[model samples]
Target: MIAYSRSIRGIERTEAYARTHPVNRYAAYPLTAFEQTPIAGTQGNRKKKEEAASQGVYSWLREAGQGQKLLGELLEKLGRHNGVASKEQLENSVHTLVDAMNRWESAYQSREQLLRPEIWEAMTLAMRHPAMELLGIKRGGQEVGRRLVWDPAILPQNPNMEEVNTLRRVLLGSEGLLMDLKRALSYAEQYTPMQLLRQPFIHMYPYVLYYGAAQAYHPLPPRGLIMNKTV
Candidate 1:
């Protein structure tokens, strides 16, 4: 009886160990290839890909799906909120947009782009969905503005009636000023997980069958872009 009990205990231990064992589960969120490396003891900013990937590990533990879904939904809502651009400005609109988008895109792609409180605010306005539908698609192939992450699937977050009404106009104006949506799309296509979410098992049969096993990453959004860093 004692031997029998000991055997049962060993079996339980093995099972428990298996359940608790670490596994390579990317189901939680998308990670760039650079983000796959392990973290260090310090939160050093020099090597960003490492920092983001490490931070990603912690972020997964605290409400993963809801926040990501919320972000997508909010983006979609913003899309619904954006007012149509009238093509009124003619020349000035394109010039103004190109300058601003270029500056922001440059900063975002650079290693120097640090997260400031003000940046969070800018992202709020910049991440609106209409930017994708209008600016991103129209100017996608330019240099790299807001095109990459502009999927129709990403839903918008719920906002007040008044805010929602104003959203479209605001986004259209912003979109008009930019050029280079393609650059952003290229990055997302190369790295982001959001790209993966839009297709295959989730998208439809033929579409999934088309890509087959050639898994790909989602493109990053134009305005609020995130990149992978090496630690």
Candidate 2:
């Protein structure tokens, strides 16, 4: 009985080791060209590649900043919750965001120009889903997806509690979206694009899939949580 238990433990340990270090399973085979490269040389090459990729993203981001600014302003206006703005104001904001998206797409077709091939391919695939849409661009005289729109009926002065709650929910959702966007932009600015690739897998949202991964390393708690910590 003791011998059987020991054998089982050894087998389990060996399996776990194999799972964590997959390359060890192929130790009997001769090293490939890539495997034969010196560790330092490989790392240096990776670093350079990452730096170049990050620079591409950085330049694209600078141009995308205009869209981000517009979104931020809209978020701020909604946050105030005084009352719904005129239809013209809301339409203007939407049009501006749409134009920004079109400009960004035209300036650098992300599928062709951004990030490493695999990264961009994955992003393109992910962005095609309907749920993944946010301020989608106009492509070839057609709209790809619709941007977020606030409920015009919701207002602080409204007597209906349900409507007020609905507005709160919308604002909260919008805040979350804006926060993720800002987080991604900030991360790309501070660290290499490779760092983003290393971040833990989260959602497929552009913000989360790209720059938002950095949020795992530098977390910013909510305002209420921060206040609680101070107390």
Candidate 3:
């Protein structure tokens, strides 16, 4: 009976060890090829590639700083509630956020200003998603490029082009901004998760997906404007 109990405990310990093991996770988030190699200036051509890769890393770090700051602000707001939130106060708070969104979205359309905060917040949320494991898509050559790790299934199959177009219009259209704002506020009230901040891999996926999607979809800003790191 003692031997039988000891065997069961050994199995349990093995299982527990497997559950916390990071090998699988590290496999999922493999380091970039550039990260794998030492920068050798002997060849000279590789030096330029290394420099560009380092710049990309710095840009991602900056964006991460912005995301961390935004998340801290959100957490502070959540902490103040103390399990009691007044409807009027919540409405006013949401209104303020929506108003800011309005200004940024408008500026983006006109190419007058582009705001990175929304992108930062989106990155934060994507990284905190429970399934976040990988950070980048495999690219040819030595440099690694980040990619969003969402399942393609997250987007509906045969998504209605008309409805999708309408949604995009609602989000980007000035005339429809107020309606979209109201809907977003309502959704946030019901579904926003505050506990994501406590997750183990909260910081990893955001840097991957945010810059990955940006590089993939929007490689450059609007015509006639250079890159604006400030906005």
Clashing pairs in 3: none
Better model by TM-score: candidate 1 vs candidate 2: 2
Model 3 agreement with the true structure over 1-63: per-residue lDDT tens digits: 988887763335656666554666335445445434453453565467446544543444443
Specify the highest-TM-score model's number.
Answer: 2
RMSD per prediction, one decimal?
Answer: 20.7, 19.2, 25.8
Alpha-carbon runs more than 4 Å astray in model 2: 1-55, 64-66, 83-85, 108-111, 117-168, 171-177, 180-187, 193-231
TM-score per candidate: 0.22, 0.37, 0.24
Top candidate when judged by lDDT against the true structure:
2
Q: lDDT value for candidate 3?
A: 0.36
Cα lDDT, all candidates: 0.37, 0.45, 0.36
- Off by more than 4 A, model 1: 1-91, 113-125, 135-231
Rank by TM-score, highest first.
2, 3, 1
Higher-lDDT candidate of 2 and 3: 2
